[model samples]
Target: MALAGMLLVAMTAWFVPWALAHTDWGNWWLAIPFVGCNVFVACTALLLAFNNSKRSIPLRVEVARGHEPLVGVIVPTASEPVDMVMATVGSVIDQRWPEDRLRVVVSDDGYSDELQARVATLAAELPHGVVSYFRPPKRGSAERIGESKAGNLNAAIRLLSDANCEFVETRDADDLVADPEFLRLTVSHMMLDDRIGFVQTIKESKTSEGDPFNNNELLFYRGMMLSRNADHCAFPCGSGLVWRRAALREIGHFPVWNLVEDIHSGVLALRLGWRGLYVPIVGAFAQHAPEDVANYFKQRGTWAIDSIRLFAFDRFRHMPWRMRLHFIEQTAFYLLSLPIMVLLIIPMAGLAFGQFPIDAAPMDYAVHFTGFAVAMELTMLAFAADRPLGAFVRTRVFLIGMAPLYAASTIRAFWYGAKKKPIYIVTRKTDEHRVYVSMLKAHWFLIAMIVFVLVMSARRDDFLLDFDPGSIYWAIVGLTGLGAFVRLSWFGVDVKRNILSRLQLRSKPDSHVQSDT
Candidate 1:
């Protein structure tokens, strides 16, 4: 529905320029916003390119050995299924570090009695003194308070810190650690440098099947995560991140106010003059959004809200000169790109009323649009330096397709987040394939608009640019962009199609699965 509406708006936009051209509004108003957005995108791409060129830190030795700092892995989960939760716990227990030395703290943010029992079972099965479960005092629903991932995490930190755990690690219930040596590798670095208080590792995807629409979300995330190394100051990601307990204590602990604690904590760490390290080692893998588009938006909304807060609140200014610039550049890149996306829909909306604006002053629109296109190309080239040509090509299109959607959601999140009424909704995850069968009414309309553009471009032969090399290049680029929308549904259709039907999958007994708050 949302997509269909956007298409209609886009089609309507074709006529906006023509209509406006007839009037005396002049091209300056339209050109100004469009040009401003273009420059923002171009500047961001360049900064990211600069960040990706720096040095990567290596793991230190014997950091997890006896008598060393006791590293605790804190996992907070809500409503995740039994199997996946267990897989996460097992992964932590199975790490190469000494079990006796490393402690796994599972915080059951879920208020469900059944899930609590599962946590009990996992704790019992583990070796003596290796794993412990902490249940926050149930107030209202877990989701409303401690059940929320960030709140639950703060609860665990208070518990472990009291227990004298020197350092804390945070991971989501669904996340998998690909490298068993994850703790040893990362802890070694932190131990060696007291100044380096927080460390986050790059995330990778191992699963081939996912809900078709958002399967590749993780790939884009990974690409962005790897690109952070270029900035010297790394951003904090929820999973595969470790923080020093003392540092947390100094900052008054994780702020429970924000949906994304990792980001909040990262900015706080920098303010305190503590360095945050980005380790390129593949520490974790996890599932992407499988079935629900709403859930996908909600997840993205959380990040966007936090990002905006980070900048609007002047959180980055607390950092040193070099580190502060990176955060500012990164945040500006994100917010600026969003308005560009939202504005594109305006031109579309205009075309629906027979306003055929693009026809009135083709040359002017062409010039403005041409500049935007070049800015996009520069953005792609900025990231293309480190990416495979194939992946880079696909990501560019994906970024383009997501612009409008991202813009809309960011606005919605900001509005709700400002009121502090945005609910923390959990995403449903099953090891089954789900198809995105319904193109929103809006999406269908957008498709029609695209078709209309093609037809009009063809009928008005002059509208179709000459088939020169540059035209051919743009044609390929545009088609690849169209592919991004189709790719959104690729994972779930491919992997989880028959997963549930093939097996009589049983929900593990509460006593058998661990539930972390």
Candidate 2:
């Protein structure tokens, strides 16, 4: 399957330039972005193919002989449910590490009195000195307190520093260690290589299979992380990442101001010559993607914006060529929203104005385009061979649905610059699913685009003309737009349940009134 896919990709690559040469370049405005978009797509396809070929080999570590270093478990929380926080704390306490060597620190950025008391109560129940809580100092100015998870983590690090901790495992308040040996296993790898800055384990979602957001996350961890692992640039995801204290100290703690501090820190560590290992083993389980679609997009938007910021960093030039290329590839992956939007728009414009951008036969173009698309999807599926087909479909749906959000975030990041105050939206895990009216309203523009394309295409004499390249292009644009609209507006089972519960509540009053009468 892999070889066949490669051959298809090769064929497409050969055909792209030949087809583009025939394009009407008289319209440079349309010509440039279109050509640029094709080039980016081809390059990305090749890069993925290359990375997918590099298989992950298990690292040999002398676990029995390695020293058990003092590990600090930092759980960063802001406005999380108390029960979730307690569950995470309990999981940390349950770790198999020596009681004296393990330290659990809950970093509370929300500074809620109730949370503080809950942590205090939990700490008292545990062995003295086993658990600690740190809140950003109130006396300092807002800037001094720092903001976002990065700030909370830095404060926790300062508190843990007094404990003489050697290694730190960072987890979200809602993430729980499913494996008792997570710390032991991950720390063993760190002990084997003095230069290993961090080991990031895959985070599985606890949410059920029906949740598209969680299903998408599962696909990413299974597919993208494999590619990243092969390239030795596995991202240190915000949660389920373990770091050496000295390595972090060398880099001046986390990037307190960055929106995606974990990713920024991972890149910085790579630039500074620290090795990062992507542990394929699942160690912890985190709450599924935000139940609230708005929160989901906001979280993704933050990542998209931060990734673009990383791509623009000047220091990336100084890294080894391979590392530099890896950083660029990773950045390009997130910065794709603009390119995708442009690609979608050009075809629609071509169909509306009766100007076929690519002067190629319908059959020839369709063959090449379909071949490339199929091969790319095949390659991605191969990477995620272990995942179910349903998961893969759901994942694609989520990615397609997020196009607008990603494009907006990228543009906003560049326009606002680095000094813009970071926005931190807490992802709440709730069974009560509520749709944001504003989020649904945001998709109106996409729906309008789809409708406009349909209307304009219907007006053309060749609208239903079979074998016409212009008609084909119009169909593709319409389908892409419609798919995006449907995915964005689709509700999950939880939302359905919420709706049913509301109806039940309303009907209960009517039933009681009828019985009384």
Candidate 3:
């Protein structure tokens, strides 16, 4: 809907030549903000385009042949399945790199005895050098929690401290490495240059089933996602990244205060002046929230709220000016999404009641420009969605749907930030198919917005065509945005089935439930 709304306004503006050609303050006042927002988007997109194309480190496999540094892989678990955890650990044991050069550490973050025993059994089966067990004592809150992931990580480093371990890696229990060369590729980047503080590999989804590359929605987000690693100032994702133990210690070991420790660690890395390299190779696969709508939003919202809360604490002052501006651009664009819905609705309401804001002459131009903008935006989105450049037009939802949802999410973020706290919510990683039903619930919101926008546009056609392009663009953007939501909801069902069948869950959804006495 957001993208559609933007397009509508642009088309409306294009029809009025005066709006496009006029520089006089009175004539093109609104055009300034409209064009300015677009210019920002274009510039950012262009910068990312260049960054994505640039080669950071030359790709080579021979770097890991002779002397591979000792790497400790840390898996932090709290109520995660033992079989899945062991499978992930087993994969580490099966690394192409020499077993002598690798150590696996599984930190039990206060789970039940059954879970602890499961991890212990796997730990006993591993080679002598590899040690996997419950977490030990550490400073501050971690000690209180009996070996929290962070504390457990610190403990792992201390245990391996004497072994001359060079790199420390962290990932969740459910993640699977698609390529056996995961350590070889990531550690190679760090080995090539001592200055490089960390190396992060690209992440793919295992449940994507079928040629994972064929999906349109995944294709679109990959650009926005991977571009982060290409830039000089890139944000970090918790999984699929490797850090230097020495560098981590140089900065205070992962601060526990913030709920989103990944972002907190990122801010620290930048401040300490350590270089982070993003590898283009897809070495690992991680699952999204398996079967719960609430789980999905909780994860997304936690990230949104944490970003806002961290910035709210005046952390930007320590960052460089360019980075500060970058953060603001990203945050503002996301935060403004929700409120923009209302801003879009007001003029839409006026059209419904026959009190349109702009004159007919300007409205025509707005309509024209909106069409051009939509075309350009879609082209960019499609290109970004599919890397190495292939058919993008067919995958327009991921591109267009972002506008309204980004706005809505941004508004929600700001409210949470204002409250001065974060809610720690973990995404569920289950194989149960029950989660897909929840997506159907969220889809209703998209349906309502689509209906509202379509009805208003059809009824108030004349006024909408007359007013500035902004309002019209937003109203219609909602309709197009629903396509992505629906696509995701549909994908959820597939994910549930794949996960349940793959894991061999015993209980079926249709089975009768009996109440306890």
Scored by TM-score, the top model is 2
RMSD of every candidate to native, in Å, equals 10.3, 4.0, 7.4
Ranking by TM-score: 2, 1, 3
lDDT of each: 0.60, 0.71, 0.57
Clashing pairs counted in every model = 46, 0, 41
TM agreement with the true structure for every prediction: 0.76, 0.87, 0.74
2 or 3: which has the higher TM-score? 2
lDDT of 3 at 129: 64
Worst 10 residues of 2 by lDDT: 466-475
Order by lDDT, highest first? 2, 1, 3
lDDT of model 1, residue 113: 71
